[model samples]
Target: MHILILGAAGMVGAKLLQRLARDGQLGGKTITKATLHDVVEPTAPEGCPFPVEAHASDFARPGEAERLIAGRPDVIFHLAAIVSGEAEADFEKGDRINLDGTRMLFDAIRRIEGYTPRVVFTSSIAVFGAPFPEAIGDEFFTTPLTSYGTQKAIGELLLADYTRRGFMDGVGIRLPTICVRPGRPNKAASGFFSNIIREPLNGQEAVLPVSEDVMHWHASPRSAVGFLIHAATIDGERIGPRRNLTMPGVAVTVAEQIEALRRVAGEGVVARIRREPDPTIQRIVAGWPRRFDAKRAEGLGFKAEAGFEEIIRIHIDDELGGRFVA
Candidate 1:
């Protein structure tokens, strides 16, 4: 079966691509083709068994989404979006890419003849606004606090509606903040979450933008790829009309993260984190959901790291060559 990935160049998308290349199958079918797309050209997975195509294209532009969907891939993973901070900072750009682009993609699929592909959309926890429940539940209403969250929520709704109409088979999973992210931090206000753990382990000083008491949900990159795969292969009939799902993750505060880092890489690594407050980042992050029940995802067999320490270990194994500065 042919599979298409939008926003296939970002960190998560790249990881998912490598994973697909390694597995070489989805939904019990041997993957014969993989097409990668992004605003910036994506690099196709190397040594892939299937024919791989990487192209530079913006889905928000007219005809691009349709052109990508024209292949009628058996599965579509929509992982592209303007990140939280960028989306909040630039309203129009975020709306265009996150909302319009997604709608266009779904509409294009809906217009297709005798075609209904499994669509795995990468949503965000930001979909739940402030005044949140102690543990956000599967039935929690989406009241997004950020433009990025708003965009994701809208996309989720669209995915549900489109699926309800038999236009597509969709599953939208809201991912948590990925900790110990490899490489330099980007514009995401949540970047500090990974920076604090990632930089310290590399023996570099990382600024802690939020207070240690601040809590948030987290998952490792490896687990994130697993969630995508599970979403792509799971029985959509079991998902019913509520196509979006809040994925399970470890919930911890900045202090807990520090403790986990200390436990994994020692106090020497922990001390490398410098506390420098950024009100902009703090405010944006403050509005994010701190925890989630995610019972549905767990019931559906999706899993994540058991704890923050496990999340740290995953980063060391996957990105740090199982070693770090002592």
Candidate 2:
């Protein structure tokens, strides 16, 4: 099987690339070729078993998506996007890259004759809006408040409609806020979710922009990669016309996360965290769903991290060599 990954340089994309390279197969089929594409050229991971190609192409550019789709990959992981804060800050760029770019990719695939790739789209919890009823279920209506959320919601709709029309096999996995994300924080309003854990582990000060009682959904980077892999390999027949499904994740508050940190690294490490409320961030985060009843995704064989402790442990093991300073 030939695979293509867009946004191949970001955290989740990089993790997916490493996982694919190490395994060298998907759904029990050997990967013969893998192509990585992003706005900037993505560096190929060393010692990839399959033939790997890296391309720098903007999906919004005319003819770019068509050119990329010409190879007719067996599976495509569409992960490129502008994060929440950046999207809200720059509306035009967000719409151009997040919405128009995704549409171009779908249209490009539709134009392909006798080619139906299994598309695994990495959606976001941002698709759901504020005033959530405790836990959001699959039946809940999407009313995104941010431009990024709006774009992902629209993409989900397109995926379902195109799949219903028999144009492609698509699975849109609505991802949770990935916790303990490796490397420096990006523009996402949820960056604090990772910062509070990641920074303290490295013996650095990290800011908590929201209150300790503030709760939100979360998953590990490992689980995010798992979701993408499952989406690529799972039986599309069972997915039916509904191409989108909410992924399951842990529901925890900042206090619970701090407690987990104290359990693992003691009060000294936990003390590194500083609480400084940002109302802008609080408002944006308040509009995000705190929990989900992802029954459909769970029943469909998608799994998530057991809890916040496990999520943090996975981050330490995978990204920090399993070492934490007391």
Best candidate according to lDDT: 1
| TM-score result, candidate 1 | 0.97
lDDT of 1 at 39: 83
| 19-96 per-residue lDDT for model 1 (tens digits) | 999888986799999989998998876698899888897789999988897778999999999998789889999999
Candidates' lDDT values, in order? 0.91, 0.90
In candidate 2, how many Å is residue 96 off? 1.5
Model 1: which ten-residue window has the lowest total lDDT?
180-189
Candidate 1 RMSD to the real structure: 1.2
TM-score of each: 0.97, 0.98
Cα lDDT of model 2 overall?
0.90
> Mind giving the per-residue lDDT tens digits that candidate 2 earns over 159-208?
99888887888999999988888898665778899999999999899999
